[model samples]
Target: MSPDIRDEAVEMWFGPQHVSAHGWAAKLTVVGDFIVECDPHAGYFHRSAEKVLEFRTFKQGPLVLERMCMLEAFLAEYPYISAVEQIAGVEVPERAKVLRTIMMEASRIHSLQFWWGQFSAELGLFAMTLWPWVDREFFLDTFEELTGSRHAVSFSTPGGVRYDFNEKVLKKLDRALQRLEQHLPKFKDMLLRSPTFRMRTKGIALFSYEDALRWGLSGPNIKACGVPMDLRKDWPDLNLAYDLVDWEVPVVDNPDHPGQSDAYDRMVQRFLEVETSINIIRQLLPQIPEGPIVDPKARAKTNRLPAGEAYGRVEGTRGVTTVWLKTTEKAQTPYRAKIRGPCFASYYSLKHLVPGSTFADFIVVFGSLDPYPGWWDR
Candidate 1:
């Protein structure tokens, strides 16, 4: 409120050049090591993916969607595929349903592993960073063994999945899961029990359940506030095998801050997410029924969708991801496509979360949300 304080405020941009901020930037006004104002910027990584979707065929649409967040490629592409199946009235086979669920959960775990490492590194814990990344490569190896590509696997399609689970694919998946299980406990203790880690994250970026919902935050960010708002349970997809598995949604109800989540709560929430994904995959793997991998009429049904609009939604790695599609009668491509990526809200919330914190804790606030640039940029 004083003229001296106003005159001393310094403005700075936090990235597109910062090592941690790959394709995003934010402007912060600081006064004596404390942030006074924050402005989060987007469009640095935008490729106009929604416009590009209109030119690609229904089958090709998922491929484009996966690129938006390759860390969760299998989960990212499902919304588009689900929309196509709705318009086409295609039935996915039981085998494909189980396979899709398994791969999607695997993708979720892999994505969380990446976030775990990156968040640790952002806080200057370099040893914690490399540990999870080494484990993440096992999941990538499994994906490559199955689909011949790691990040952009193009595994799922409308009415079913493109690749069936072969013996080699299953073995690789088993290996990855086993490796993760063996090491996750040690890694959890290292971060969660560390006094230094707690000092940095415990009270940082605090948000209430009401504020989170108002800002449209979901997934672990909201779950950390003791709310079980996962689409996999709330709005179960008929084509996916989540109904076939018995697992509870992972949530972190921090007693220290009831109905609110701080940076440490979010960190604990992600660890729980990885565990739940593992449980889902383990249960579904053995239950894969003997049947066709895809519908026999999928090709004809999806070739030219009838005039209709459909919305597809999934509980993605970060939050609720969705694709709204419109098509004309006998159209090979969509009339219009709209994508809603969850990180848009998380990134925007920095304007509110950063101002009261010290300048050094900016990345702590951002990393806790587990935001991916492609999710917002696309």
Candidate 2:
């Protein structure tokens, strides 16, 4: 509206249709070809999950939380369930612990595949997206066979998991792990060898070691920045057999790149992480001790936790998802429940990152980070 504004600096809308946009569009003010500012508008799929949870029984809250991040539903549910169990002082059965770990790993790969493949697609490399999706579907197929749902699995409950795993699910899991292992190299080669991907992403985002820590980035985003901090390893309440698995966290802060944490590095970091995750799954499956998937006596309903406050944090696909719960001694519902989603932190960084970059590059960076907008808007 001002004479000082560049003629090309009109606001452009990246509508909800784009894959990376995650069904939420932005009103971006552009000057020439660079995005000067972005009004990120979400609520496209706002279900008001927290408000809805108040109405459901305590045992039914996991279903509400799982939808918070459909891609990483199990990971999202873990902290919430853990909070409930801790508040109620419920000791989960050993079999349920192993099943929870297995489900967590499966969800991690499932969500990473989406991030890795979408990164390629956002860069206009169709094959990178297609191959990984095809490969990822193999894993989803296992989830479906096991839980009877591919995504938005409400398999988890407050006391323990809602159902049990039979020999059939175990067999399916074994096959899925093998397929994922076989496909990992192909995914890596497809992303790593692409010159376009490398050129576009390399040395772009540039969040330094201190900056990453300052911003409180986590998961692959932090691990990619040469930090070995993983909540699963840092906090052992997860009851994971991480020590049994031989894998390394991929940390790459190339001096040559010189504080440049670009889209390429972010992508390559995921490539490395995916390989690590696959290797971990391989060792975990064969070593999976004979046990029930859930506590045989655990009730599917009417499992009320203690009356107290408890917090649970887990390394979700995007980052740390922390669930806080407050319970009343004689009540069957939580007095208060809150979620600190990692994507919410990443979304704030966008205000700093989006400007000065082309709209397309903004999309590239956004996709590479793979923030689950649903987690934030919910």
Candidate 3:
């Protein structure tokens, strides 16, 4: 290598910090204030969750799976549980389906608010961070009241859920979500609607729609690119949730360029998903049936299926999360498990996006994508 080129760039490390929220450890090659290249390290966060799933009984697996991400624990657990149920040929009760839908929506609200808070916090908007948590508490309260625990409830099971959604609790949840809707405008004004925030984010970190697709982005990331791709919308009637809920997949293409997606659009997409969750919660509560929450014979102790394999997927707050389960005849434990973590694609694509941007812009881009580093290199 030429001495001049070596002098042109210097290397630096972003993190491998003991308590990083995103658990990232990246090495960057920079020229002055601009990043020339970035090589992100991943092993620091590998949990090997798929391998761990093989060691636990079907009912016990979710207990560990929920540990993959703190903010979206329940959402991470859903795909795997759905996989197990499918391979076992388990039929969920109508009431249980309703309960699952409600819980999934509620949990999604928690995750959206979480990322909202993190996004605000990243920009030094501490007050906005606190504001979203207040709304998120409404959903967490509902979880605690219904499932008897807050995070990692493990309430979802192969046949159905571990508990029923009581009418009174549903009423309480409805009231809480309605209250959350009332406070949305204040946050919009503070963050998304703020002129300063727009100036910083609107024209910055713009990626082409094709680039978004090539990088395998999902959730708000891809939606912001105008792809309108959603597992719920693409896969018909996986259950009744997506089909019956009647929700639109929010798409946010670049305003200036008309065909691109930007950091601001990603934030806008997230904000819209928050509103959609409220709508979903309201729609499902009244529709919840009065029936058994679980099928008696579908309990894990009695699960003895013929050897087979099945895959299940669901749209999570971050994106589409998929799980594959293979079973041995009459075995209560899975012979193998494979997980498709939502944040992994974005994690790998960071190198392509980070170069040629200022160090200041780095925070904006990373904060916008918001990949949970725990999901990477695993």
Candidate 4:
């Protein structure tokens, strides 16, 4: 608050150039090693995806959505598809429901693996970084087998899915899961139990459950604060098959923090998220009935949707992702499409969470929130 302290504070930008920043940047005011202020920035990666969605046909909108967050392509694309399905009144078949759930859970696992590797690398644990990424390739391989593309596989479409689970696809998916299950224990022990990792992450970027909710945090970030606020259970989609499986929303109750979460708790929470997703996939895989993977009249139905408005929400890998859609009568494309990405709030919360922490730990706090620039920039 004093003039002398202000004189000593040095202001600097943390990226559009920083290796860790990717398509985002932040302005930080530092006094020696401690950050006196943080101004989190967005818009660097803006691609007008929401506007682009309005131009795409009802059935073609998922392709644009998937590109926003390719790591969870299946999850990323579903919200748009969900909206289109609602407006068109297209019924998703039982077989399609089961398949969509299975692949969505698989996409969740793939995304978590990518996050684990990236977060570890940001913490300067390079070895831990490559370990999970190597395992992640198996998931990519499975995705390739299923949709003939890895990252931007437009797997989920309005009224159903684009691809059916062939025996080859099932075999590849099982092998990927097996590899992840086998290596996850060892990876967790190596990273979570390490003294170095604890020294960097434990008790860092701490936020109470109430504060997190106030900041609009969700997914593992909220789950780590001892709240099981998962949309999969709380707001289940009738078209999806989550209700068929018996599963509980994973939550982390850290005794030391008591209704709060630190970086360590969030890291643990993501591990539990991956496990829960794997369990869901395992249960749903067997129940995938032999029938149509898409609605018989889906193409005809989605050709011209009646005038309506719909909200599509999904419990994504990062958090609660949603799409709000509006259409005119006999419209070939959406009249309006708006996306509410989970990362936008998480990135904004950095202004509150980063100040008073050391400059070196800024990335740790940012990465702990698991923000993807596309989520916010769009």
Q: Flag the better candidate by TM-score, 3 or 4.
A: 4
Whose lDDT is greatest here? 1
Count clashes in each candidate, considering only residues at least 3 apart in sequence or on different chains: 0, 6, 0, 0
**Steric clash count of candidate 3:** 0
Question: Candidate 4's residue-wise lDDT over 1-378, tens digit each?
Answer: 478999999999999899999989999999999998899889999999988988999878888899999899999999988888887877799999999899899999989999998999999999999999999999999999999998989888777888888889999999999999999899989988999999999989999989999999999999999999999999989889999999999999998979999999999999999999989998888888888888768857888999999999999999999999999988999999999999999999999999999988999999999999989989
User: Sort by lDDT, best first: what order?
Assistant: 1, 4, 3, 2
Of candidate 3, the 10-residue stretch with the lowest lDDT total is 235-244
Task: Tell me each candidate's TM-score.
Answer: 0.98, 0.91, 0.94, 0.99
Q: Rate the local accuracy (lDDT) of all candidates.
A: 0.93, 0.74, 0.78, 0.92
Report the alpha-carbon TM-score of model 2 versus the true structure: 0.91
Question: After aligning candidate 4 to the native by TM-score, how far in Å is the CA of 330 from where it should be?
Answer: 1.0
Candidate 2 scores a C-alpha RMSD against the true structure in Å of 2.6
- Compose the digit string of candidate 1's lDDT tens values, residues 1-378: 468887999989999899999999999888999999999999999999999999999989999999999999999999999999998988799899899999999999999999988999999998899999999999999999999998889998887888888899999899999999999999999999999999999899999999999999998999999999999999989899899889999999988889999999999999999999999999988899998898868756998899999999999999999999999999999999999999999999998899879988999999999999999987
Off by more than 4 A, model 1: 1-4
**Which lDDT tens digits does candidate 2 get at residues 1-378?**
356775657877886886557567777899888888877776887787777766667777888888888888888888877776666555666666667777888889889988776777778888877877887787787788778899978877765676677787877777777777787777777778878877788766667667766776777777777777777777767444566666666676766765446677777777776667767777777666665555534443335555688888888888888888777766677777887888866766676678888766887767767788787777
Instruction: Give the Å shift of residue 122 in candidate 1.
Output: 0.5
Q: Candidate 4: list runs displaced more than 4 Å.
A: none
Q: Over the stretch 175-208, how does candidate 3's per-residue lDDT look in tens digits? A: 7788778988778778877877887787677888
